[model samples]
Target: MYFYNLLSKLKYIFTLVITTPYYGWIIFLQIISGFFSIAGIPMLIPVLEYIRTDISGAEKQGHMGFFNYVFSFIGVRPSFYSVLIVSSVLILLGQILVFVSTTIAQFAQIKLSGEYRKKLFNSYLAVDWLWLTRDKSGEMNHAIIREVELASVAHLNSQRIVIYLTQLMVFLALSIKLSFKVTMLAFVIYGFLIIINAKNTSYVQSLSENFNETFKRLSTLTANILQNKKFFKSSIAYKGFVSKVFHCIDQTMHTAKILNIREQLQISWTFLVTFTFLICLIMSHRILRVGFSELLVVLLVFQRLSPQFSSLFENYLALNKNIPIHQSITHRLNDIKKNKELCGDEIYQFNKSITFKEVGFRYPEGKRVINNINLEIKPCQTVAFVGTSGAGKSTILDLILCLLKPARGTIFYGEISHDRLDIFAFRKEVAYVSQ
Candidate 1:
């Protein structure tokens, strides 16, 4: 059950929290963009092979793959300069596609972020008032505002994950074509780092939630302190104010620093692997007597792939950090509909007297606030109940509107019971003015 809940939240972050429901085309664009971003990765192999063997103004070197096809299209004896131009053009096209793909990712992210906020806000409106009242002011404020922003970041990170994963695969494929030994070394170094990081994912996740909860508590505390500064000041409560909470907040911040350090290490470990791979490649070039151009291509590919891979790694850490906000949002909509007040078909008539017969009320798990009240209000009557603060004035008004049902007794709306009437229609007929 616990694992299923976690999986559900992860799924929610990807579909509901990060993107719109109608995101099939957007996801298709992501895959296509990812493909285009790495188009140039393998082009160098065929291009360089063509340049080295086929067009060196010597014994004819055989052409293959894309380069071979292009030469076939030209259908004439080609100059060395023409081969260079063809390769350059292919690389240029790849770069253009990469740029276009990036633009598409950014555009999709903007559109998805807007859609998530709208979807979440609507879900908030549909939540049960009982659940809504458990938190401060309508909803968890961050769930509406701050968490939505985090969700935008989540979208951006997810896009990076796709793009960078594609780039890594392309680079590895090219490296394998160049030399199996060099590729293995590259794989071992980076793969080890990923494996080590994966083992700590649970710890990282816990830190994420701890940081989120602590920061939320601190935010609430700060808001309360400011809003009620007069009460706190007069009560001599400002001196030790927030001391324990601040300690908790500070510890959470320290945990955040630890997480950041780990993320930095994950990224730095990649750089270390890159440099190590470079050194190993140079040694292999000297020992294996491989062509410098070929080795250089492998080295350049690794260098290019590293930054994207690092970006991907950092984004993974960031995504983990922000997923709690995603889960909180999905929780709002999940299994919550059953708790909302159900409406009846009947609408109460207000033509006759409304009666509260030995009506009693209390919040769940609390002492009764409205106790055994017997009252009646006739049509066109003006009546008021005077009470001190903490009295049940607002509770009585809420009961009249059918917002709160009596705990132990009955309330009647004209000739019908309150529960039988449609609360929305009943409330509409009555006017409530609150200051």
Candidate 2:
């Protein structure tokens, strides 16, 4: 259910699933290989115990299930020795499969990470100029890098979730073979672990925001140093720039240290639960009158289950933490996307002159950058505008180029409001080279 919500927002889910055979194939193979490894565990403990006792006839008792089924099919009676040999082979093969699968996943992760980074870069490149000015360069850097890193981390962690889920299932089957009561106890403990981790979602989200802010401050500090290097090196300002970078780094480290401390505290709770589970096993052994093998089975099951459950909860918390950052970055990106210039519109056709009639303009904040004005230009005439600095000269050019729309009056080309003309198309027909 956690994954259900997680996967819902990532647009790349379909791509990830469809490419699973391509990207996550090794992981799937490892899971299949791991099943054999888990099943062999039950067989192993008994064999070793029998060997320790030096019993001669105990050989027949150890060889059962898959070993017997496969060997019997091949018209061979799998001796205790033979089953032991076969199980070792299966275990070795499974180990190799898991290693290879993880290796492949890491490689695929790098490729996908690069692809996403490229897409983000292209999206930024295609957007309008306004975004470049509105968003500080450092903040954009912070957002882009944070998203890329998270996407990579999430993708890798997501793959592991599959591996862990497979391992859990194998362990669940083994636990069922041991005792239904023990398995149920383990399941309840796992559910509790999940709830504990889920409760930390708000903290995780807050941490993510803090992390981004730290990086942004650092990025801004760095950018300023680079841009003002001359000013820094020429005067006593060098110390000031150095001080700012240190200040940002100091804040970044402070937040980071707090998060690390919290994580360590959380780990203590895991240890507490593990100790409780161990106590539960002891009580269950005496109450249920379970044999040594059954006790060993429960212990082994808990050994695997504790780490699995703990990891599941930790990963969920981490995912929740990262999702908010991912969402924030995406929101900014989408805003940039929405602010993009319109494409594929019909080019406006004008055969006569261009004119501005009783025109006026003001910025969005209502600072009047332009005053009432009337102007005309013939189809093929060269004209010049003369005015002092801040005398609405640049504003007039901005209005004509359609970079800024006038708040009052009209600009006409052949008696039509120039606003109706495709601004992009109009710009192509007329070039205004500015100083």
Candidate 3:
């Protein structure tokens, strides 16, 4: 089950990366930068060893094969200053690549958010009125604003996870070269820690989902209040509406507080475990009979690995939290596509008169608004529907304007049936004034 969930999360990350433009370039840059960053850490070990040796010594005491190979490759003699310069150069190059990659990733994130927002907006515009009316305007706004932003952040975090994983692999490889047993021990300890915290990760995901629901409710409530503030304030229901808003806000805040506490606890626990591991490495050096230089390198590697582990866990939790938002957006887009307004090819032209022959209309909720209505009006003729508010006056107008299709019978533009006429082109001939 755990492995299946892990694969699912990985697939989500892969889909997100693949959908974004220039993501290939971003991953490539991240890999190169991660290599440089972890590769530079091991250089410090050789440089430290070179510095500890006598300046005029004919040979070094510790293993210098790695440095010797690097120096030979660069056609430079193995000296303290030479190794130090190369180490600094490698670290600097890593930082430079990191800066470049981060800049591009950030740009990609912004572009992605904009593209998603635009796509969602276009979907809203293209969707039929029936589906649009069924959805809350506030929830749609929240998806376009908050949900998209969170999704973009999730994408960025996924990229960071990639970079961190790459660096961790490099660290592991170097640590193994220095001291295989210690490296394996550290790996096992960290893996155990992850297993221990798996439940917390799942709990955080639940809290995130709860928070999303509460916040969306809050957004919808506030939007409703804003839209009808005058009516709400003048009516006796003002207190009730206000109380509901406050309740939603409280629920949202409560969920957020718990989520933050869980995250902090995870961080604290990770730190405690990492500190204990570091202490064990220091104290067991004698028992392991590990050489000073190799032990120091292993320590350095583990020290860096600790934070990478912590970051990976943090990002994983965040990714899980935001996955629902992405899923919601996908579902929304699919619904919009499914509910797209119907269109026809033939252009509508007004000639002679408009006629409704035994036309009937009813809403989806079984509201029979119009029934068997026969109507006709010539071009340039002014007509008024005289009926009470709940009557089918507006429904008849909508049928004429092609905003609503008839449930039975046929409406015609001159001799052409409404179904054969392009609704958009038909609307072009209409000049409506709404109250």
Candidate whose TM-score is highest = 3
Instruction: Give the distance in Å from residue 142's predicted Cα in candidate 1 to where it truly belongs.
Output: 2.8
CA RMSD of all predictions: 4.0, 5.1, 2.3
- In order of TM-score, best first, we have 3, 1, 2
lDDT by residue (306-376, candidate 3, tens digit) is 88888888887787788777777778888988988887777756656889999998899999999899989
Q: With candidate 1 superimposed using the best TM-score fit, by how many Å does residue 395's alpha carbon deviate from the native? A: 1.6
> lDDT tens string, model 1, 277-326?
67877876877656756776777777877786677667667777767766
Off by over 4 Å in 3: 55-58, 66-70, 428-431
> In model 1, which regions exceed 4 Å deviation?
1-61, 70-82, 123-126, 137-139, 335-338, 348-352, 388-391, 428-430
Clashes of each: 1, 0, 0
In candidate 2, which residue pairs clash?
none
TM-score of each: 0.83, 0.75, 0.93
**Model with the higher lDDT, candidate 1 or 3:** 3
* Model 2: lowest-lDDT 10 consecutive positions: 12-21
> What lDDT does each candidate get?
0.67, 0.68, 0.80
Backbone clash pairs for candidate 3 read none
Q: Write down the RMSD of candidate 2 (Cα, Å).
A: 5.1
